[model samples]
Target: MPQPNDHRLFAVILGTNEIASAIALQLVRAGYCVVLSHDPDPPVIRRKMAFHDALFTDTAQLEDIVAERVDDGVQVYQALRRPPQVMVTWLGLLDLLPVRHIDLLIDARLQKRRVTPDLRRLARLTIGLGPGFSSDFNCDVAVETRPGKIGFVTDARWTDAADGVASSLGDVGAERFVYSQFAGRWHTPIEIGTRVYRDLVLGHLSGVPLLAPRDGILRGIVRDGSEVPAGVKLLEVDPRGRDAQWTGTDQRGRAIANAATAAVRLHAARRSTHRNPA
Candidate 1:
């Protein structure tokens, strides 16, 4: 039988978005084994930095950490045995892993709705990021993800309500986004770091042009040949036109990572105190 403290903390992050990937990298840096769960067909717009892109490429590297797609629980365990390695898998394969091995479960999906996973009972500590999760009924802790309230980790009974609007960038606001007009395979004609003016054609989806909404650097965009649905975000332009946006983790992602680290430590200390009764 495995004891509670028999091994390093094994954290399963349920999503491969930027924040989730940031958290996984942070946990690995803290000497914890991390696994990322993602969908087989992830509709992620920021393919350059998202760990979910490993689903299509089979492997992805964030900073210095590398994540490889694994097929089953055995592979996940094997990947964890190698320190600094992270495993990526779809939800079904994630469910097949032994729940006893999970020390923490962080729901970083940011779906703005109730997650279907039985996360509270799946691990010793569970965390939900953004909205749509109640600490009293869903998880042990909920971290605020809204722009102004970013990184506010709490265990209160209530959860924050999603505003359903993207955080504005200075005076640029929502004009930095470009969406597809038709559901079909997407192809990009311009490179990611290219600076472009408003109305410049960035790509096309089933013959419909994906135009730039404003003048800025193309900070992020979906990969070419991706099957996209109509109205999906296809690209993002950084109005600041800074090259730093093309590389490394963003400020918001790092803040969320810090909050998750604090939550895990707090819960681990509490559990230890309960077990030893010092």
Candidate 2:
């Protein structure tokens, strides 16, 4: 547990997806007072492996790391004092900064858009994950998440950019995911890791049917009651069978998370050099 007045470096992570959750977990272990922000109803696909459920469940855990949802800055401080529990909040990025100064800020949303420079001064060290970010352009540092698995920290230039196509397994590309066709509230009674068949109605969007594209294990789905727009991701199927583990951390997520931790250390090293150079 961390105390409000303690000297721990504070970190604000701007997403609750699995990748963001991984970064929070690693930073917390690295002794950062970490906070996560999320939408009212985040359309996250991987619930089993993400802290996104904490926003609804009040508490969610991944690989022994527990995340507890807090409503406001007051509750956030309270949650921090509880040892080993990470704080998750509905407070947006703008509202959070005024609550406390942040040492680092990470955008793990993977939105794949050219980010505005508005967030550059938000923290002492700001990091953007994935292809849409560039060092000195949008964030202070950009971490590479190209071709889906690799993660590297970049400086002085943009990391790998997207080519409008996602890397996939031999045949998994394009066929494994389901995207929304129309705009409406997403509803689903199904849980992640559930077994299903091809063409099964897994859920609905504003009363319109959401069918399973192909038979396989359900790897991810948008949260029930999420108001989504057209072109939004609805769900994903693993097609890898029921025995495949769909929970806990993913290999790619861990890589990206490790890189985020490295970025923090990199910034610290540079600061040390400037203040006490040989």
Candidate 3:
């Protein structure tokens, strides 16, 4: 059972992909009380995280996991009643399951065909469940949204127009839905992984000083340690060298250099976990 001050973070990492597992592991390392609930919990998955209340066998097993927590004297009534604070669904999950929350929905599976009826249905489902709830909420077949951020991870593989589609989600009544496009030439997934993990860590520890991933040439020192605020520019990433420049900022455009480095450190922690498994 966690204290009132301890964050009661619930997450569901669906699928068996390395990327999905990596994201889940990163969330666990970031101090989130995550539950990797999947229909099929593989041996590799169990071995990777050892055994944790954080990992559940499947969605149906969620009640069992919660009950176990209760037996252990953990307070999980609100968690059982409310949707998870965080959910990292794989691209495959989007095709079948209607994701539950919109406050921070992310689509990492943009490799599939776009503009299809299926895609539109998925989009509509996401929009409806996201921060802006649709009147069609009576349907039990799909999940619903709460509040916060919804995003799609993009790289060169994605068309420029995709950004417009993702960005337009904000208009559907979400407080904000962003297309987190990366401008890097190599290791796109690795970088996106780092960025998302960093932001997740920050969001979990403190509610202030949000980190918004952006595109540009980055130049800055990699600092180690916490205590960085949302407004300090820890690094510089000028798009056109010094001649033309662009700076990374929070969703609010606050310079986050110091905080940015703190974000980087979070990724490092993820790496450390991979290197030294429990």
Candidate 4:
């Protein structure tokens, strides 16, 4: 176990979606102290594949990495000592992390098609993934998340837009995703990995019943009692049944994560060269 405060590179990821969780896992494995900033109730699919549930369950594991949610600054410090296991905080990681010590900042929230604010000066290196991110404007670096180009890191001024559809799985397309029909508290008894059939009452939004679109495993869903806004993704069905993958770091996620780690490595190497030219 690598010591927390002992020269290991530290990274802060904004968001706890599966993408963020994947990046955190690879970074930890590659010898970086990683911390995630986000709340517990994410409208995230693939619950077992991410740390968004850590805030709810207090701990979530992705592959060999475990993410524990820390309540305050003191707990964050203590959690760090448990090497390779990430610690998430509801409070801002930037606020809790030492002033100006963050080596890398990654925005993995993947706010598709939304024009987010510029991420300059947040860390020594800032990387934004997926659409609406471009190097030199929104972040120091931009990584491609479009299909066929998941890990193409670049310094380009613009990136392609998301097609407004998630990649298909087990021959299932966007129809497998369930979204909130209105802004309200979401309620559901079905847990992750539960088997369900079409028309099953998976949950409700402010009393509006939500039903399954097809027969399959409940791959991911919002926590049973989360307050969710209209149009946000609420749940997903894998449709693969016996072949369903309800856990572990996924393939595309790993590609995106590898890109993040690669960008950091290149940035650190460039900085080192500039400081000590040979």
Better of 2 and 3 by lDDT: 2
Which of 3 and 4 is the better model by lDDT?
Answer: 4
For candidate 3, the per-residue lDDT at 206 reads 30
Question: Mind giving the per-residue lDDT tens digits that candidate 1 earns over 26-74?
Answer: 8988887788887423356555566877877889988998888876777
* Model 2 lDDT tens row, 1-278: 34554455778888888899988889888777788888533367888888888888999999978888888887765544555347788899878877667788998877765454546888899999887777868898888887644787776787777665755643576677789888899899998888888999999999999789888888899988889977757898887663455799888889999888887898899999999999
Collision pairs in model 2: 1-83
Which residue pairs come into collision in candidate 1? none
- Estimate the TM-score for candidate 1: 0.87
lDDT of each: 0.76, 0.80, 0.26, 0.81
Better of 2 and 3 by TM-score: 2
- Residues 53-134, candidate 3: write the lDDT tens digits: 2233312112112211121112332343433322222234433233232111222122222332222242221211112122
Which ten-residue region of model 2 has the weakest summed lDDT? Answer: 76-85
Off by over 4 Å in 1: 1-8, 40-42, 91-96, 113-118, 181-183
lDDT of 2: 0.80
